[model samples]
Target: MKKFLATLTASSMLLLAACGQEGEKSGASTSGGGGGSGDKVIEVWHIETGEREKYFENVATQFEKANPGTDIKLLRIPNDAFKQKLSVAMSGGNPPDVFQSWGGGWLKNFVEQGSVTDITEQVDAAQFHKNAIANTTFDDKVYGVPLGISTNLVFYNKEIFAKYNLEEPKTWDEFVNVIETLKKNDIIPLSLANKTKWPGAYYLMDITSRLAGPELFESAFKRTGRGFDDPAYVEAGKYIQDLVKMDAFNPGFNGLPYDEGGSRQLLYTGQAAMINTTNSFINNIRAEAPEFEEKLGFFPFPSLPGGKGEMTHVPANTGPVFSVSTKAEEPKLAAEFLNLMTTKENAQIYTDTTGSLTAVNDAAPNDETMKPIYDYLATATHMQMPYDQTLPPELAEVHKDTTQALFGLSMTPEEAAKQMEAKAKEMLDK
Candidate 1:
């Protein structure tokens, strides 16, 4: 980090003095540089933080240095705070040149409002991963570049598993049996906190697809006049409630803040046996206890007992992306900065340092916790983008709320099913 910074600090001082006269005449933020386009600056914003924060800042600094005539500024916001800030900024017509975004139906609203620059032609489609790129497209036009990608991971503690002589589960029945066995031994089957709402919905999204199969969810989401209460979703929800009834999740898991339940800490301390989380958690584990580097293991969401979809059915997404805004002054510079930030070298570096999965097909996972999920996707007969991304924003929020209520044992499969059906119909009436 220090080495990376030293080179940047040294070059800027000299670049500044030489460009002083040019800076005034050229109209660019940096006199002679700024991509030879003159005064415009490339401003990039994102919510990547912690180990990933350095990763982003390092890339921005390098992009500026590599293309010396250019001035690039990166703002890394805390994730918890980004959504609110981004909304306000974009509404005021002061959106950043490029910023991280998920490829959800919400993006449709952004695209329709002309808030994001369509980069379909600016970037080489062939260079980006096909699956990653596919998710970002709307009405056959692309608007963003891939920054990072991730998959849901089943993380288990090795020492705890070894002590219990537990074999990692490969199938859904096996997984349920293991949970039952663990319960018999007085271990909380797993740590889950539905109070955070989205986590519960995400779990339902990932696992229900495992039980009900992909086509059902896709069909329901695609809106051929059907809705979320489809038989498959109800069955899946029932299965979820079954898990809840087993007293499976930790006591008061419904009340715990998803992240603060010390859920990751649970795996680290052997207090809990497993956590179903994004591969990103691997880095947190490594940071909390270095020895876990060897103890950490991963498994995919298992195949359903009687479902048609193979165990290879996995949920995946380009974690988020940076889109150029139409209101921005520096279109060319924004494109240039986008290219630099997502260069495979930097992408791999960030993945390595933060234990993240990259969006590149050729990039290797930073660690073992993600390998199984990646391997499954490579051969997956079917992979679904998470429903949150696939569904309209209004409908997605309903699912989130319903899933949250379900986990609290307040909404049954039938009731949740009815709520979703009403929502889909309400939206379809448009």
Candidate 2:
């Protein structure tokens, strides 16, 4: 369980080191494409590999073929490596023409540094969902185009629920009862792997949204009226601890990983009744346990009584936001490539090939398993970006770490909330 340590501070340090140095020019060829005369090359860096990498390559080839004398260089980097490499590139003042981003506080840093280009005029904002566009926009200016949208949901084994004569819960009390019933039946109520830390964060995030609503959470993160030490966050952590006391998650969940023979395996083997994870887990079910796919169903996080948030306010955000660099050799052409990537045709291809929802308004999944997700996003009033993506990198790490501690019973809810507030004030109060 190696932690990914490429934080905003690491990138800022690199930026400081490279300052006043004559770094290589932006859009310069590093590996791909031939430097032929009179050719316009748009270098794009992304963290897509395997089948998804092939999709990007195909798009580049198509774009190249359609526009002669233009080269679309695709640099596919692994997830962990991409963060470090992209940070170094940004700091060195030679960023790619188009690059992948998560488009919250991460992109906001680059935008504030003038490292990213604003394509608000060129991009048709009306073509995307408001939530998708909202993630990429800063200070009322659009800095990127979102490729797809993703959200967290509770995926349950319908067969297990049927065996216990249980139905999906709509309220917190009902959800707790469902958990107690599963526990009594000797079923693990939730399959959570928190070794990487982010998995456990979903609980606190969803609970906070339900209890305090999005406004208070936003204000806390932004260091406005309320702060992270608010009773709401502590209450959310207490709720998670209550679940822990109920033996809701698999044994040694904090030591388990999400991939391979871990929490997901528990669900596949029918040892676990449910898993609260992102919609992407649907793909895992299809790939790893096709037989279990039929038994899988999903539902929104149950609402809390007297909560300020609506059930429609989901914990979600755009998948991968692509932005053109301000240092791009051909800024207009770079913008064009981004536009091409999200077009209805390419978006449909993205959806069909990836089994995920694209940010394009017209492109949606037609499958029975995925249609509910599409419907959820269609009606969602607020798509709350994950804390790890929305908060500054350092603060985000504290969040994950504290949430993991909460799940492990290593820290009290009040202690965790205070720690988070202390860090938030140090980082955000300036």
Candidate 3:
């Protein structure tokens, strides 16, 4: 069933690519040095800006120094422009030597369209975490190498929690009590930026996994049973509405942007008590509110009573992955560059500079506050991908849009579930 779903997703990608996209080619540029005499230039497209951009540039410089002849032409694109630009580039038959990817459905599309090169025999698959490897694998072959990994959790201000005498909740009921207490004390309980829609979908993903367990996700993706209209999905919607009624989220959350210092600002400045987000959010804190360092704390999303889900189960993925493009002028060199980027030395640099966990076995971030969260993910029994990214593109959008409307009080839990189920059926039936 999983194989069938994968094939279906790949076919859909082929259809989209063949249809062609309409947009002016993006105005992105390559800034790395040209190759040595007689050496090949490996063009790379990545979606890292600020500190991470410099980190990758340094990695490329080291790779060129070691390889002597191969030069990396690195092009950094902003996240909003990345997908469309990459798609157009591939459809136009000029894919980069290496590009950033999220694997799962996103990579599968490129693999089907022959935009990504298969590197199963060229790289060591065992060096990365098992979950990380799985995300980049299709048809028993590796198409990309993981750069780093991420896991989601609730980041809170310790000073605020202690000020209210609130303990980190261990179960759903206790979590609700925490929210109610924070509200009574006139504090926003959760920092959410739903203007982008993806933020709200994370909450639904967390609760749906807890209420229904991971098998429900697999079933939905594979079209085996019940699908998105499952009782658990409806229950997840109800949970979000309950939080909404308690005034759990920050003001104008539905209009706030995640990247522009919306929720992170709320937590850093103590306008809000907690944020349920990915581990990389620490980087935001470091950049925006370095003074809040000692006051921050991390905790996994709490479990519900009688829930079959493990508290140790986390929504995690290898941070953006790097894949060699099949159309690259220097595919081997591109793959080699990818290999160099994952070396222990480079991986550690990634951790030190980004404050994000690495998929490399020993490359946990060096920050003291981030160490415990990295250690926790190291032993997690299950690492689930964000549901929206896991589903086919159409259905993923349905999940995102429906969840946002659910939060806006425009749809009942049942209505949202039915909408999601309808989209799932439309895609799966074909």
Candidate 4:
């Protein structure tokens, strides 16, 4: 939906257009800036496409003006191609001076490989949220600056709830009951953005933690030596299957693109009562349909009975991470850019524009889109990284594919969990 600039291919438009490119991956298509910056350029790459691209581009321009001697070579790429291009750059010893990375699975590989420079000493840990800091830390070392922090919150259509006289669910049974009631009334209970693999996996992660607490998913996925197909993960899968059987998900979920699947639009259109998405959906809805804000409200995902997880506990993680290359020539300038870029002002700009929450303690959410995330982050008793981000790439992708299959009724909950375990073993054993 919203992309950051660090995912770019470092391509210059003029160069690419002239090549009349046939099979030649014309354009810079790599790195953030031109090397040997005659003017000391710091290359920054991300996937800030759509309207938000201009916002961050402005942030870069501001930084350059503030620092005078510094210039940021900004490249914005498509999300699907970012990781592949980033890998090529890092392996070739010409990584961008600063780039966008987060969601632990991606960051960890580079951090472990020493491809990224550690910003711990330069960054004040006290200035950031502990939950975010924890996500970016490895081997007790902080490897990246959390670009933002986010918490999962359930978004419900107030009009639908009032029309049905339904209260926001507080526990698993009530949540299921609510879904059933909505289905019986000929309404979709949930708007799911499963067309993209991550959204389906998002639901699994949400329930697994609430059903089994953060410990199970965290331990299992994070290689804490715990089993992946435990009762908790299985039980969560079953719940997902139960909802699927009731036909609770919005129509066209599997067919629609992530943003278009109506996960963000359903509540706006009253086609679905609620959506399982990040706080960013709040902003998306407002921009897509402003009147929906009056009809929208949010709640933390309810906890299952007899679970260690709190009803208030949410799926949370560092919003995004910013890191620099270990081979950068302008290291101090990069640090200054990082420092200047994360101040409450810049954080506010990015968060306000993207509907993300700042990791910095003093930065208050300026937009209503992030209000729910902020509320949960401030009040939740506990939070955990999503299973996808907590686990290695292979395990995380397994969760993604299996979770989507389970919702599509192609796999039973127990079968999904068992397969997850098999996959985990296969990957971890090596």
lDDT of 2 by residue, 179-269 (tens): 9999999999999988878789999999999998899888997778999999999999999999999899999999886654499999999
The most accurate candidate by TM-score is 3
In model 2, the runs with Cα more than 4 Å from the true position are: 1-40, 49-51, 259-261
Every model: Cα RMSD to truth: 9.6, 8.0, 8.9, 7.5
Question: 84 in model 1: Cα distance from truth in Å?
Answer: 2.6
| Candidate 4 worst ten-residue window by lDDT | 29-38
* Model 4 lDDT tens row, 323-375: 77888888778877777778777777777776668788777776665665677
- Which model, 2 or 4, shows the larger TM-score? 2
Backbone collision tally, model 1: 8
Name model 3 segments beyond 4 Å from true: 1-39
Q: Relative to the true structure, how large is the alpha-carbon lDDT of every model?
A: 0.72, 0.85, 0.83, 0.74
lDDT of 2: 0.85
TM-scores for every candidate against the unseen true structure: 0.85, 0.86, 0.90, 0.85
lDDT of 1 by residue, 259-346 (tens): 4534665666666777777666765655567787688777877777777666667777676677888987878778777777677787
